[model samples]
Target: MDSVNFELANDGIWTVTQLNRQVGQLLEANFSRIWVRGEISNFTQAASGHWYFSIKDEGAAVKAVMFRGRAQATGFIPKPGERFEFRVNVTLYEPRGDYQLQVESMRRAGRGDLHEAFLILKEKLAAEGLFDQGRKREIKPMPLAVGVVTSMAAAALRDVLTALARRAPHVPVIIYPAPVQGMDSAGKLVQALQDAIARNEVDTLLLVRGGGSLEDLWSFNDETLARTIASSPIPIISGVGHETDFTIADFVADLRAPTPTAAAELSCRTRQTCLNQVDAAFNALTVSQHRLLERAGLRLDRAVACLVSPQQRLQQQNERLQVLKSRLARAASAPHDRHAARLALIRAKLAHAQPRLPELRNELNRQIQHLSTSTQRLIERRGQRLKAASQTLEALSPKNILERGYAIVRNEDGEIIKNALDLSVGERLAVELGQGSLQANVLQVHALL
Candidate 1:
C-alpha cells in the first residue's frame, strides 16, 4: 500500500465522546500525579463512601473524586468552603472524556507543608535530647515580669493580654513587637528574644501566635529561633497556632501551651487565688493564736487564785500570837497551885497503892532473872547446833575427798565422771589433788564391770 499523507486541520468535526476521549488521553499522558491548591466547593459525601467535590480558585476549577479507600485513609474530612491542598492522579473518563483528579491524600493548605516540617524538626530535636523533659527548665511560680514576643496587633496578643488581665493583672508585661510570619519572621523573633534578655525587662518570656496555616507559623520553626529559645536564660512558654499545630519552638521552650491565652495564663500567678490562700492561712493562724492566748489567760487566773494572799498570812500569824499570850497568862497565875494540886493527887494515889507497888517490884525482878536465864540457855543451844552443822558441811566438802588421797578426775570442761565408760582415749581430763589441779589426756581406756 502506498503511504497516505494528511494535513492536520482544526475544522474537523468531532463527536462529544470523541473530543472527551481525546482530552482524557492527553490529560492522562501528560500528567500522572500533581499537587493542587484550592477552595473546596459542591462537596458531597455519598452513601457509597466516596467523596465528590469541585476544587476552585479565582481563575480555574476542577472536578475531584476520592474513592472510599483513599478517603478512609485520610485523617481528616473536608467541609465545603474549606481550603485544601491535595496530591492527586490526573485522568480522563473515556465515556465523557471528562478531565478530573483522583485524590490520594489531602490536608489544610499551607499547614500541610508546615506540619510536615514541624514533624521532621521535632523528631530530629528529640533524637538529640533537646526536647527531653529532663532538659526543660521549670517555670517560676510567680514571675515578677514577663516578656511577650508577638505581633503587637495580632489577635493572639490581644487574647494574651485579656487572659493576663483576668488571671494576674499585677504581672508586668513587656511587649516585644515582632512579625509573626513571612520571610524574615524567624530572624525578628530571635532578635526579640535576645533583646528581652539583654534589657532584663522580664524574668520569663512568652512566644505566641494565633492559629493559622503551616506557612503562617513558619517563624517558630526557624533553626535560629529554636536555638535561641533553647538557650534563653529566661524561661519561655511557646503558644503557636492551634492545639493540633506543633512547632519546633514548642519542643525547645521551657513550656508549651496550646494557645496564646494559655501562654499568658502560664506566665503569671493567679493573684486572686494566691490572695485567697494567704487569707485562709492568716485566718487559721489567728484562730490558733487566739485559742492559745485564751488557754494561757485561764492558767494565769487559776494560778493567781491558788497563790496565798498577804492578808491571809497576817491573820494566821495574829491567831498564833493570841494563843501564845493566853498560855503565858495562865502559867503566871497558877504555877504553884497547879503543882500543889498535882502533888496532892499523887500522894493520894501513892497511899492507896503502896503495898501493891512493893509486890509488883519483886515480881518484876523475878521475871527479869527468868528472862536472862532463858536467853543464856538459847544462846548455848544455838551455838552447839551451829558447830555441828559446820562439822557436817566440812566432812561433805570436795576438798576432804582430795585430802583423803582420792583425786577427782574431770573432763577439761570440768565435768566429773564416776564411771570408767565415760573415759575416751585422746580426751583431756583434769585431776584434782589436795592442793591443785592437773590436766592429762587419756592414754587408754578399759571398761570393766
Candidate 2:
C-alpha cells in the first residue's frame, strides 16, 4: 500500500488508513460531545471488558463502544432492547474505516431531561450557598418531639413511627400529613413543614418517603421546598427514597438519612442509652462529692494541729507591752536632757565670742581717715586731666584757625569755596574772619597755573 501525504502530494489520493484518519479528525472537530437516546441492540462485552453495542430507535441506528474504563463505571450492565441515553463523541475506527460513537457515560432513557433540570437547579442553589455545610444546622441530640412530613398513606410514616417507638417511646411524635407524590405535592409539603415550624413543638423534623424513580420523587426536589427546608428554624432530617437515591431536600436539610427509620433513630437517644448516661453522671457527681469532703477534712485537721492556747498568747502579749513601756520612759526624758546640755554649751560659746565696742570704734575711725585721703587724691588727678582736655579743644577750634590769619570764602549759597575755579565772575561771596564777617563781589577770577 502506498501512503500519500495530504500536505505534500498535489494530487488528492490516499490509503485506507490516511482517509479514515482524516475523516475522524473532521468528525471530531465539527461535532462536540452529545447525548443520544435509543434502545440497545446487539450488545456484547469483549474479553478485555470493552463494550460494543448498537443504539437504535424506530428509524435509525448507530454503532457505539464504551471502553473498559467507562464500561466498568456505568454500574448498570447494558442489555439488548433496553432503552438508554448515552453521552458520546463521534469518531471513525481507523482499522475498519467505520463511523461510530465513543461512549463517555450512560443513563436511563427518560432521565436525561429530568437529570438535566435537576443539575440546573442544583447548580443555581449551590451558587447561592444553599448547600454549604457551614450553613447546615446540627440535628438535636435529644428532641422533645419528632415531627414527620409525609402522605398519610405513605409506608415511610409507619416505618418512622415504629422506629421511634422502639428507640425513644418517651419522645412524642407529631404527624404533618401531606401528599408525597402527585401534582402540587411540593406546595403541600412546604405548608406542612411550615406548620411544624410555627407550632415549634418538635425539636427535630423528618421529611421522608419510600424509594421511587426520579419523577416520582421530584416533589422533594422542588426549589420552593428546598428553600423552605433551608430556612426552617427547627432542624430537619431528610430521609427520602433508598440509600442510593438523592434529592435536593437531602442537600438542603440539616441532616440526611438513608432511610425513614434511620431519620427516626437519629432524632433522639434510645431509652436505655439515656438511662446509661444518667447513671454515669450520677456516679461522677458522687465521686466528686466524696473527694471534696475528704479534702475539707484534711484542711480542718491541719488547722487544728496548728492551734495555740489563749493563755500562752495573752502572756506573750503582756511581755511585749512591758518592753514597749520601758522604751517609752527612756524616750520621754532623753530628749530633754540632751536639749539642756546643748543650751549650756551654746551660752558659753556666746560669752567667749562677744564683740568689743571700743576696739571696733577705733578700727572704723581709721578706715574713715584712709577713705578721706583716697578721695582727695582722686579729685586732684581728675582736675589735671580736665586741664589737658581743655588745652586740646582750644587747639582744634575754628576761631583759632581764623585768628592764625586764614580767611574763609563762601559762595552766594553760603557753601565754602576751596578752589579759585569755584568762584564765577560777578558772583557775591561772604568773607569770614576772626572778629567780623563781610560780603564781597568777584571782580576777576584768579587761577594759579
List clashing residue pairs in candidate 1: 20-97, 111-214
> Model 2 off-target regions past 4 Å?
1-35, 39-82, 92-100, 103-112, 309-449
Tens digit per residue, CA lDDT, model 1, 193-305 = 99998998788899999987567877888878988888888889999987766778987899999899999888877977766765676567557656765675676577557
Q: Choose the strongest candidate by TM-score.
A: 2
Instruction: Report the C-alpha displacement of residue 305, candidate 2, in angstroms.
Output: 2.3
For residue 122, give model 1's deviation from the true position in Å. 2.1
The TM-scores, one per candidate, come to 0.48, 0.56
lDDT of 1 at 237: 95
Put down candidate 2 lDDT per residue, 26-69, tens digits, no spaces.
Answer: 77776548888999999999999999999999999989999999
Who wins the lDDT comparison? 2
